[model samples]
Target chain A: MSKELIRLRDLVMEFDGERILDSINLYINDHEFLTLLGPSGCGKTTTLRLIGGFLKATSGEVLFDGQEIGDVPPYKRQVNTVFQRYALFPHLDVFDNIAFGLRVAKVPKAEINERVHEMLGIVGLRGYENRRIDALSGGQQQRVAIARALVNRPKVLLLDEPLGALDLRLRKDMQNELKRIQQALGITFVYVTHDQEEALSMSDTVVVMDKGRIQQIGKPEDIYNEPKNAFVADFIGESNILDGVMLEDYKVRFFGRTFQCVDKGFERNEPVDVVIRPEDIDIVPASEGHLVGTVTAITFKGLNYDIIVEFRGFKWLIQSTDHCAVGSTIGIRLNPEDIHIMHKSEYSGMFGDYSSYSAEYDELTEDAGDEEE
Target chain B: MKKNNAILLSTPYILWMLAFTLIPLGVVAYYAVTDPVTGAFTLDNLAQLRLYMPVLGRSVGYSIVSAIICLLLGYPVAYYIAHRGKVAQKMLYMLVMLPMCMSFLLRTLAWKGLLDDTGIINNFLGLLGLPTLRMVRTPGAVIMGMVYNYLPYMILPLYSTIVKIDRRLIEAAEDLGCTPVQVFQKVTLPLSMPGIFTGITMVFVPAVSTFYISQKLGSADTSLIGDVIERFFKGNNMNLGAALSLVLMVLVFVCTGIMNRFGDDEEGGVVV
Candidate 1:
């Protein structure tokens, strides 16, 4: 196992008296691919900049190799960045651009030349040493940028949405290529992006953030399979979050039915949020299911069918390979292992009960009628 | 034939150019080749350039020196203005363009008052018990006048181009083991070459052909090619004047061509 290479303790960042990052604590292991995953304005990019030394935190300590690095300049730090737009020098050709850092350090001429050529070959651009930056395609320019940063052999590489500008096919190709390179070099990689699938496929540890705070940090499987809060469940994948009550140990009550569960230690009739993965719900005949519902919509997703069913006025989204006809009654079954429970937060008494919503809607319409009369 | 509306719309400008630009150039060419009084072609007018060779040399030298001085003084100011806040940028623009809005001759005359023997500058120096200095009517004074009048030409274009450079590129360079000074040298300086070329051309072309500034600020010993050309034409020596004018145009073309080659030619011209 790799040891801890970097630690962020009690970090806080503010811009114009408004907080951007609030009291974040994290530890990154050496040779591990750690990803900061969040939506826009969620402080993922701000956290990356703080680590890269481009922006200073309001209060905190950034410890590297068991020592605090207090506002040291970027040039003196042991990290490099691949910017979002692939900020290559337009004035220099590929060779000279890749050789810029080495020349600044006054490296020997022969070594600079050899290392640049090696980088070119590694990036699969052996004959593109003299091409101008604007002449290359987006993917090719991205490779050159990677080569320029990696030629210096920095201790950590910070990539800030480096694949954001590429199309879907090229993005997947580069994602696999980046993982291959990171393993071969065995350097710490701190990647930042809002693409959930990209983070899930590439990261060893995913830190999910929302609104300037970290909600959860775990392995990809743990985050997807067992989220701690409703936000993490909704952000990572398509989740059917419902309002339920824990009747007692190993049992929960929802939709007026009590089902067996593996969770314990909740107060009797404690209100909780239930997370059921779409793929975990199995569709069966009416007599074999615990609850019966009608299919409202069915969409072909090429790999699987995304079907929505309505049971007790609550819509359930299910992903399955079996085909189901719309406007047909169906029964859905859930196993005890598929039901995960968590304490209600931010979204309590607000979901899985359609009777209250219809009641409110009826009240509003009646008020409008009274006003007209 | 096709009835094109664009050709009809451009007819006025075509007539304007033919009447004002091409015809006058043709007349100058005719005068440079033939004697003005006798309708006979001769090379004597072109050969008379030997008489004014020193003035031609001095004109080229002063324009080059003044262009270099404008660059050295204007670059830092342009850089500072480009990096300023929004309110400060607008205020700096007003300050830079305020002098340009006044009449050019009026500004040169104002400089004359400031540089005279008993001018305000000398009076202030006398209060400090310093001896008076002579600055009027010398080559140095002529170059100074040129720089003072044309400094904005260098600053404006440089500002427009430098402001468009992506700030992310500088940050990326700094993240990749580059100090702040190295970031300027490696990224900022090379990217702003288009503005530098335009600024040099803007200052050099007018400085080489100016006679008013030299007459208003310099002594008799600092007679430039413009002074000789003006004298020949105003005194009815049109043939020699036309030849010298053609030579001056050629010299300006060659100097601008060399400067353009030094700029990064891929970048298009900055509008300002």
Candidate 2:
């Protein structure tokens, strides 16, 4: 394992007597692409700011290479940030903006030119040196922002939703481009983004946060397939969560049926939450399937059909390539290893409500309403 | 019918512009190029402006000095006010605008009264057993009047523009290895160019052409082109006064053009 280059110990941040980041500890290894992923208002940006030395911790230590850097100002720290709005200096052209840090350091003019050109090439904005910041499109401006930060060549690059302003196509393209750049440079990147797909696709380690606290920290697959609680499962992707009971060892009971799962170490008759990915559950014939339910809705998703089935007053979202008619009874089969069981979490009861599904159901019914015409 | 109604509704505004703006300018232009009595075109009135060269030079010098002083003083005050919280910002803005609500003539007269030998300030100095130096009718007093009366124009524009700057740029600069002073010099100063241009124009235009402040506060030795123009306009020399006014207008245009070039045009070029 790599050495820890940045460490946050029991970090707490408060604004106006209200907590923004609660007591928390995190470590980022050197040359690792770690991403802080969460929804809005989840304090991911605050955590990144603390690490970037832009914000002082209310009570805790921010250690860089085992040295406390809480009192260090942002300029003196070995970290740079690409702000959420790109924040490219409107007063300077693209070349000067990318060379800002080097110029402030009084770097030789010849060297600043070479490095700035190199950064422009890296961001694929070679001919945009003289372009005014406001004249460029949003994606082009974002590239300039990235080039400006990366030109500093700091030990850690903190990006705060850098691609949030781009459209879907550009966001996807930049996601791959960012991954390629990070890999080539091998710099420690602590990226903050609310887009789960962005985090899953690029991060070496994903730190899932919620309400000023970390919910889970693991690889993308672990976070997606083995979320420790309901919130993580819900936040990361679509999960069909069910209230269930663990019947000791690997046996779990849900929907009036006991099923075998890979999870163990639960006491007999223990209350638990069960999560199964929509794509994990396979669609079999009604007679051959383990569970039977009536299909309430179906929508074409190009790659797969997103079908919602109601079983025992609970809706299950399943992605299948086969065509299934609405209001027809269908059967779903779950593999033993696909059933993820965990102890009840704070968000377990808050989710899985029919009212929460009202919007999607309304859209589905609207299509049906249109079909009837 | 709707468009016609809209055009008819704007008729009063058109008439107002013609009466207050266009007619006065036409009259000035006519007087500037023609002899007041003979109604014959002449360049003699324009050439006669050279006789008041010393007064014109003094006007330019004093306006430059006042603009520089306002900039040096107003920039820091505006920077401080921009960083203040919302409530304090509103209260301080109200305080800055309070003096502007009073009449300019009255304010200049109040300064004249305060600077006189037997006025409140001199009396206070007398009670302190200090010498009451001569300042009532001097170029220094006139410059002081200019600075005091036009300082608001400088402060307001500077404050508004500085506060509108995206604060994240400063933070990003610092994050990229800029010290606090470097951040200010690189980010804050360059971004505040628009305000500087606006403030300089706002302060310099009135300071350059101010007649009452010079008349009320300065000696005859410190007479500016404004005083010369006022004298001609009052003493039956309308053509010459009109020519001098045109010269001042040209000077104002050249200075504004220079300021506009120096400012960051992408953000805000001219406040007006």
Candidate 3:
């Protein structure tokens, strides 16, 4: 197991009597890429700021290398941040920007030149040293911001949605580039983002958060395949969550039908939330299905069709390569391992319903999410 | 068509500048080069400027001192106001500008009244058994008057520019391991250069050419170029007065030019 680099113990942050982070306890491993993923207003960025020493927890201890560092200012901490807006100094050229921390430390001139040039090459902007910040495109500016933070040689780097400002194609490319840089440098990275796909694709460990609390923290695969609660299941990916009851070990009842599942350790007849991933469900003939439903809507996503099936009064979105036309009767097959079950929590019945799903509404909520923090 | 419409909309402003600005400048130039009585072109008015060089020097010297003082005083005030809460910022900015609503002459005269011997300040000092000091009709009093009258000009520009600086830039600097003082030196100070230059220009230009403050606050030994120019014009020596005005204008231009040269490398170069 890797050694712990930073730990937040009972960290609570309150602004004007309103709690922003409520007793967040987390430990980041050395050289690991841990991501805090959630929608905006989930205290993910606030948590990142507390670790960066930009914010002080109202009541808790922040430990670095097993030493309490809650009193350390941001400049004294051994970590740096790439701000949400990039925040490159407009007055400085690319070279000076990358050389800022070195210059502040009063590094020797020759070493400053050598290290700045090396960082420029690392960020793939070698010949563009003299370029003004405003002259660069958004992607190029993002590279400069990364280069600026990385040149400080911090023990841990905190990135708060650094790729949030980029377009889709550029964000993907930078996502891979950031992963490569992190692995090559072998430094711990604490990244925060609202983009689930970016978190899943780039993180070794993903922390799902909501309403100022950590909903789940696990490996990316574990987080995706076995969410701890409905909030995590809904936030991580598209899930068809249904209120279910555990009849016995490995047996769950939902849609008034008993289905075999891979989950256990629950009390007999305990109420649980059943999560079935959209892509995991396979469409079959009406007679071959465990339970049948009519297709209420069909959205053609490039690789697959998002078919919303209505069983009785509940709507479930199922992703499949094969298209089922609207008003057609279809059935979904769920393998035992494909079913994920969780104990009911505060977030039960709040998400995973596709009855009101619309692409425009999703985008509207995404835009609203961007304005939160 | 759009460009033509823009030009058409700007025609009135262009006409106003030509009438009140350019034409008046031309008239000044004409008066400065010609003999007053003969209406004949001559360099005699310009040649007479050598006699009053000390007065011109005093004006430049006093204005430079006042501008420097305003900068030292205004920068902190501007930074403080910029960091205030929204309502407090507006209230503080209003307080900075409130004195400007009164007439400039009245404000300077009020200072004269307070600084005079046996005046309000001296009377208060006498009640405390302190010796009366000679403050009125002195160079210090004149500089104080100029600084008092022009401080708001310096602060307004500085506050506007400082407030516009992105707070994230400072956080980014600190995140890059810059201490508080280093953050100001590296980020805040350099970013506020435009405002500094603008404030200097705003304060320096008016302070340099102000006749009322010096006349109201200074003795004969402290009379400035503006006082000289006013005397010449009132004494029916329009040619010499116009020549002095031309020289003062050139001096202000050269000073602002130097300030702009130092400031041009930064983005959003000096506002005025």
In terms of TM-score, the best-performing candidate is 3
Better of 1 and 2 by DockQ: 2
Q: List the residue pairs that clash in candidate 3.
A: none
Please write out the lDDT profile of model 2 over residues B1-272, one tens digit for every residue: 99999999999999999999889988998999998899899998998888888889999999999999999999999999999999999999999999999999999999999998788799889999998878888999999999999999999999999999998998988988888899899999988888998899889998999999999999899888899899999999999999999899889888888888877454545532
Give residue B25's lDDT in candidate 2 (0 to 100).
85
**Candidate 1 C-alpha lDDT tens digits along B1-272:** 25578789889999999999889988888889888789599888999898888899898899989999999998999999999998999899789888899999998998888887888788888999999889888788899999999999898888887988888888878887889999999999999888899888888888998898899889778888999899999999999899999889888888777777776563545221
Once superposed on the true structure, which residue ranges of model 3 sit more than 4 Å away at CA? A359-368, B265-272
Collision count of model 1: 2
Model 2 agreement with the true structure over A1-373: per-residue lDDT tens digits: 8899999999999998989889879999999999998877888989988888878889999999999999999999998898887999988999999999999888999999999999999999999999999899999999999999899888899998888878889999999999999999988999988778889999999999989999999999999989999888877777788999999898999989999899998888999999988889999889988899998878897999888898887888888899899999988898899899988988987654333465844532231111000
**Which regions of candidate 2 fall more than 4 Å away from where they truly are?**
A352-373, B1-11, B264-272
Q: Which wins on DockQ, candidate 2 or candidate 3? A: 2
TM-score pick, better of 2 and 3: 3
Error of 1 at B47 (Å): 0.9
- Residue B228 lDDT in model 2? 89
Q: Which sections of candidate 1 miss by over 4 Å?
A: A347-373, B1-6, B126-129, B266-272
Lowest summed lDDT over 10 consecutive residues: which window, candidate 3 chain A? A360-369
Give the range where candidate 1 chain B is weakest over 10 consecutive residues by summed lDDT.
B263-272
Taking candidate 2, what TM-score does its chain B reach relative to the real chain B? Answer: 0.93
| lDDT winner | 3
True contacts recovered per prediction = 0.78, 0.95, 0.88
